[model samples]
Target: MAVITGGTRGIGLATARLLAAEGADVVLVSRNADEAVRVADDVARTTGRRVLGLAANTTDDAAVGAMADAVERDMGGAHILVNCAAEPAGQKAVPAPSEAQWASLASHMDTKVMGYLRCARALLPGMRRAGWGRIINVSGLGARRTGDVVGTIRNVAVVALAKNLADELAGTGIAVTTVHPGLTRTEKVDAMLEARAKAEGHSTAEVEASMTQNLLMGRLPTAEDVAQVIAFLASPLSVTVNGVAIDVGGGVRGSINY
Candidate 1:
């Protein structure tokens, strides 16, 4: 069984779908219970994989605890847990933020960092009992790039947390890893592009073209692009790739010399 947080939309949704395609039973968690159920059913029907959808606000402790219970009750308690739910509200740079900005930044750590730990705390016991498990965190390239201040902080937080947690579980049967995916075309991107178009006096398509041209692949990646890598990591073949940072950006290089 696979439990994916923020599994109702964006990259989270795509990762869930990819796992289902690979024949893993999936349980996707998100704040919108209705959306989760609807999407899970659709994916179950389309991919022929058993899927569970549970409503959860990962930032809330009760919600995260309840989510683990729901998974145990509905989807066999998860043999795999994917921390894909991220708070992107703080994607903008500083100096433009408002008084309520801390909530936005705090929310990211609450959900992506501490929230992920809560899930791990609840689910790792079960996984350890099973003697096999996979925990994949979906942090983005922006975490290391730092061009976008807020994102870099959030991404870096998850990366550090993942590394620390993986070390703690070094000898366990479960494998923990992080995936850094580059620009992917999603609804969020479309909305951003639309906003950019209006602000820059250009069309959405034109803005999208410009954005894609700057990417290494000369095209924006789809949720499917990153999801494929996730499926591979969850596979048995990648058992030895623990505590590692894998990039799924189609050769998108950053400023780092390494």
Candidate 2:
């Protein structure tokens, strides 16, 4: 079974659906417990696999611990874990910003980076006993250093954590890796573009055009695009592939060491 945060929407939702399609029972975790269950049902119906949706804030340590226990009892111990939950902190103004805005970025880091740590620590015991596990962190393109301060830093921290975990867990059959998805075609991204356009006094098209112009493929990466990479890494085939960040951003100008 796979336990994924933010499993009700965007990349998280896509990842859950794809995993179910590939014959894995999934547990969708999110703040909205009701919505999580609904999405799980939808995934189960679509992929013909058992999907358990649970509402639990990723940042809540107790919540995470309880969910981990539930995962073992309800869906069997989660062999695969995907940390895709975030505070969604892509919004920013280039030149000037406020303290509250900075806190927002910190909050994003707390929910994701710290949340990943909490979940990994909680689930490691089961994985260690079984001698097999897969942990995937949903980082993003420009995670290394893309001129975007908070977002870039957050991604880098996640990638660093995954790499470190992979090294530490060597010979434990636990693979830790980060998948750096490029600009994904998601409602969240669209909303960010709209806000940016308004702030910059440009049309949404103009902002989008500028954003895509940097992509080698000239298009936003689809959720499926990143999901394919993640799906492979989660499989037994990628047991040897560890401590690496796979970039899914249409070959952007800046590259990170994988």
Candidate 3:
């Protein structure tokens, strides 16, 4: 079974659905119990795979512990973990941070960086016992290229964390990696696009096209596009690939790296 935080929407929800379709029983973890359960039920019905939802605030130690306990009791343990939880970036203003912005950025770090660590540590014992596991951290392209301090710092921290975890668990059966998604076409991105379209007096399609200009694929990636890669990393097929970041951004041209 797999446990995915932030599984109620966007890339997390897409990942859950795809994982379920591939015969993995999924535990969808969200801060909102009702939303998590609702999405879990929907995935279960659609994929005919066992899916459960449990609520937990990643930023809270007690809640994360409870979530780990519940997963152990209900699902026996998780073989895969995908860290996909984060507040919407739109909620915060950036581009030129002020002194007062430091506190907000620190809070963002606590949630994205520390939250991921808490979940990883909580579930490591179970994975160690199972002798096989995959932990995929859903970081963003901001790790490689960014225009804001909040995005860059948090994402780079995730990459660093994943690398360290991979090194610490090198001889074990667990494989840790990070996936960087860019300009993913999700409900959240669509909303942003629409708002920009309205504000700039340009069609939504035009704005979307502009967003894809830097990508070799010439189009924004769908959530499913990134989820497929996540599913692969969670499977036995990805046993040899560890401690690295994969770009699932339809190939950003200027940022190309070997």
Clashing pairs in 3: none
* Count of residue pairs whose backbone atoms collide, per candidate: 0, 1, 0
Q: Rank the candidates by TM-score, best first.
A: 3, 1, 2
lDDT of 3 by residue, 155-229 (tens): 999999999999999988999999999878899888889999999999999998987887898889999999999
Query: What lDDT would candidate 1 get against the real structure?
Result: 0.82
Pick by lDDT: which candidate is best?
Answer: 3
Which is the leading candidate under TM-score? Answer: 3
Better of 2 and 3 by lDDT: 3
Instruction: Tell me each candidate's RMSD, in Å, in order.
Output: 2.6, 3.0, 1.4
> Which regions of candidate 2 are displaced past 4 Å?
92-102, 190-210, 254-258
Q: What are the Cα lDDT values of the candidates? A: 0.82, 0.84, 0.91
lDDT tens digits, residue span 152-254, model 2: 7788899899988999999999999998887787778878889889999999888888888878887778787788888898899996789988878788666
Which residue pairs collide in model 1, if any? none
Winner of 2 and 3 under TM-score? 3
167-252 per-residue lDDT for model 1 (tens digits): 88888878888998787777888788899999999998789778776567767778888888888888788877888788776665
